[model samples]
Target: MKSEAQTPQPNDLQPEKDEHKDSYNNIETPATDAENSNIIDITALENQMRNLSIGFNLKWLDVNVLPRKVVFEIQHDVQQKILKPLEDVVNTMQTVGLLSMEAQTIFKKMFAMFDGTETEYKFIECLKSADLYVVPREFVISNELRPGVIHNEQGMDNDPITGILMPIKFQLRKYLESPLVFDTILDNLTPSQDGYIRSLVDGTIWQQRRAKIDCNIVIPLNFFFDDFTTKDTVSPHASRTSILGIYYYIPCLPGYILAKLANILVAGYMLSEDRKEYENEDLFSNLVHTLIDLEVNGLTISYNGTDVTVHFMLGFITGDNLGVAGILDLVESARANFYCRMCKRNREQREKDATEYEQTFRTIDGYENDLLLNDVSNTGVHKNSVFNQIPSYHVVLNVYFDLMHDLWEGVCMYGLSHCLNYFIKVKKMFSLNELNCRKNVFVFGSTNSSNIPNDIKDTNIIKSKIKMTASEIKTLITFFPLIIGMLIPEDDPVWSYFCNLLKLCHILMLREIHPKLLDTLKSLVETHHTQYQQLFNDTLKPKHHNIIHYASFILRSGTPRHQWAMRGEGKHRDAKQYSRVNNNNTNLCKSLSIKAGYKFAQNVYNSSFVTPQIDLSNSKILDYPSDITFNSFVAEKIRLLNNSVHFIDSFIKQGSTFSHGTIFYVTYCNIINIFELDCILKDKSNNLILVCSSIMCRRFDEHLQSYEVYKTQVPKLISNIGCYETHTINIHSVNDKLYFRFCNFNVTDKVIESLFVN
Candidate 1:
């Protein structure tokens, strides 16, 4: 509740005293003030130079580029020219030690051609081209036992055999004994340089140019294979074996160069200052002491092959190197002085706050009645006040020092210990409890939550909330955000965690809205899977008409009842039940039946709606067949009305609301249905045609009197029988097509004649 800024601490007086002393010293030397000032300026410059030297030294400890280049060049030359040629010579000599002059001459020529070229490729070519090529087995007869010798026979011969010589083995030994042979060969093929000339060139142009050197440092070949075998022997009976190649890169050069440069720079800087008499030599001395201290207290040194490399480059640069022993003394002294200063400051700050609080307390009328402060007589209770409490400043300072010590120890040990020590130190300085408190304050202040004191809260609530926290709010403010992130549409853990924190914070803070409101919203969205269903319906509604039309076409194209019996029956049941319950036998009943049928049919097509089946057996029932009517006049009227209902339902369900184009299309489609009735009449038998014509004429008179006919075509057949046979009418296709059948009817002569005469 208290402001962190109001909490004060003591200040050191030594800095002030030192300033006064310096002023006094200046006044005492009034005759040479300018000279004295110059001395101080020079001292400051020297101190800065010392610091820069230390920084560079630390950076150099990690890597060195200068020496690395030399090492790399040496390695590159050895691998490309020396190692490959030596390997080939060793392999060749093993098979043919003593050769005829002609063969030896040819061999030497081929070796010269391939020596520094693509050695592997040219060697393979030479072997294939050679007239007297031999594998290792053909050359050796006596298998003398030696450290690296290989034998396949049961016994060993102590003396050299007649035609046998180990070419690869002999050549390898020759090269090892005399490495100068390959070096000389490479020198003849490439450029030559003496040590003095190279040094001269390096001194003249090295610093002026940046060289980009690239090379694939080879891994040692010896490590890859244990032994090898030879085939195609001259005797066709002997065998041979030999060890494969041997190599590893030297990584010390780069680091070495870097350390050398650092030493040069640091030494140069120190010498430069020593040449001039700079004042405050103690500061530079302290810097030198710090470097020594870091080397001892911070740096970790290790050897790689022949070169020495130091870890913790920063530590080296920052170290006070008065010497290892002196560095420790400096650290101890600094730590003690820092701690004493902090402790004194905290005590002074506490006393100042206590005085202010006492002054403020006197202004309050019922200060004695208020229980804000403890009685001075009670030591235990009084100890709880800020005046008696140990300051957090000292605690934090101690933590920082401990952290530095741990970091030093970690660098010496290396690996996870170093990493863990760093993390622990960081956590100690920025405690999680304090972090949480700050987070809570930010959240409350931002949301304008009533739980936060108004006086402490900001007036521009919206803007304040926007700027309140840089970090995202926790998963505790609102339940809807959580539930929506979780179950309603899809699951997302990150979103859910965030929302949950927001909601939880909201509840804990007790804002204007109750927790129940969020719960209810979640419940509504979740209940009956309503949110999911609504989302699905809204997405699918526009496509519903097209789906229905496709389904109807598929059914009319001759799908058997058995294929869709369960689905059709379910749709019929839904239509009938919904009609019976909601319509109450009014005109709405007719409308409901049509709407329900349209909706049900749509669901059946979707394959998502529930299907009707026998509960116990899960068997489907077939849709009822339509019955034929003798009264053609009544049937025509019913057909016209059904067509209208179908058109309206389809139009309303598929068409976009408030669109004139949709309205026009619906009207046009309905008109087309009316014209279809006339086409049907023309195709019927004479007797039925007469009946259809009369019905159409009467309907036309009632509905189409005001409109002029664009084209009129009267059908040529008309006939009727007073008594007709009952027939079955199959509603094969609900939309676009229908089929019917007449059965058990006698065709009277008078009716047949009337149909022909008409």
Candidate 2:
């Protein structure tokens, strides 16, 4: 309700003064007395000139005048060029009803020409040109005059009414400084006030009327005299009658111009008030607290009925800007309060009307008559109207809802909703997936009998299928990871990856896929591969020799020609021909071939073998059992071998035993190492390295059990090794190749630490 002029005072004026004072104090002073003496005393003169400038300008006529001054300057050029034309059009509109299409078009063109441009000088020019007076007066009036009735000898008509009236001409000479004195004298002589006095003395109504008419005649004569001097161009005596005739009747302009000027001033004042309100201490403090709450707690304010309610929600603030939701909520709350108040007032009025009707009719028999009368009084013969039955709460709530929607619509113009919806969907998906996984795990055991078997055959088949399904799910979840990675700040690489995985889980949950199950399988595969690759590269004589060999195998397996070349025999010829025939038969066959390639890669890339220590630990036969325990033997052998010997088999064979032995000795050592046996039988004089083939055959079945467990469990063990944990080597063979590939390099250690420690 406070005017806008009141608002800007504290905000603009005080700050400006303080800034001026600060600038003055901060100004560099002359160092020498001579320099100080030479400095001009301009401060007082500047202040004087500034005050004079403010006084002359109509925009600076009031305390709240910043925007007026700005607008006045900006429209000066347009005003200079178009003010007369616009004024003419306005005057014409007053005389005529509505403008014709052509006249309207011309007016629109003029408005567009002035309004669309941004010239400060033109704005000042416009303000200067608009300073025209339709009628000359003896005194200058303030431009800040409000719309109201003014008394004149002619009559007490409304200020805005337009009609012919005697023209009042006045010279600017005598009354320039004391315009109010002249105005006071004329006001006292006007018919509306002084006519009654004249009537009381004259005793006759006719005499009083003539006196009033005489007083009206004097009003024009006063201005004419002011415009004239003792001697003029034509003599006062010669033009007395003509001047009297001219002064009798002229035109009266509407007072609405003054009213419009007042309205413009009011609007400017309101704007200033708003500015000051923004700078007020109490309001600013409240705003600061509100903003802080919005930032820290995700706090949002809304109105429920007449009361304001605040809401807090957790999660990162999204969209283009922060605190958008909080702002929207505040607006909604205010609107709800407004609607509630309005509804309450309406309900009160309705209840009052109902109570009055009930009080008027006391008896039951008179109720019908009273109801008819009440209906007729209130709604003109309405009988049980639908409006009467409409619930107040329903109407209030509807209005509240509408206002909230509008408020949110404005806030969401920046596209916050799309981002929020996407994030929410992902979060929900993650939650649902986790819930379902827990439920499933509770309902079923770790392994199913129908799918899993007691032997290695069934276990291998089931594990492979599970791994394939998990890989597919992982690939699907990567979409979310990619999006999350894009959203996270580039400076936070660790958190970026963390959020990427979290979002991936969220996306899978939304899709109704069990993320926990997929995540577990992914972890397992990653652990196995990471550990195997590390040990394989670390122990190999040539660091990546094994990996290169694996790549070469893949390249050969991909094409029939390469496969036949690698086979080194004619046995592959028929098989190669058949593969080509199958490829041409169907698109399904080609798809299957691609899938087979991927499966083969997965198997070869993720192969897990037991560490040499575990293999030796399970060995039952040893020549020097006391000296050749599992840990000591494997550890010593690993220490003796080069780090790269596991992958570079030729290097290992060349470095030791093979160089000193014949084909028989080489074959015997290879068999013993491949099969992972300790020499239990002695030949001649502690020749334990050479064992009887029959003894070896006898223990072969027992060795197979240990070998199977070593192959399976060693991979699991190596895959589970910590980064800092020590490992021992085991000799294992695949496809007639003796290799020490497995070493304990656990991947689970880091993953567990990250997930469970904090």
Q: What is the lDDT of every predicted structure here?
A: 0.23, 0.24
- In model 2, the runs with Cα more than 4 Å from the true position are 1-98, 101-292, 295-308, 313-522, 525-758
Candidates in order, TM-scores: namely 0.11, 0.13
Candidate 1 lDDT over 482-524, as tens digits, reads 1111122224222232232232222222111222333432332
RMSD of each: 47.0, 45.8
Please list the residue runs of candidate 1 whose C-alpha ends up more than 4 Å from where it truly belongs after superposition.
1-405, 408-758
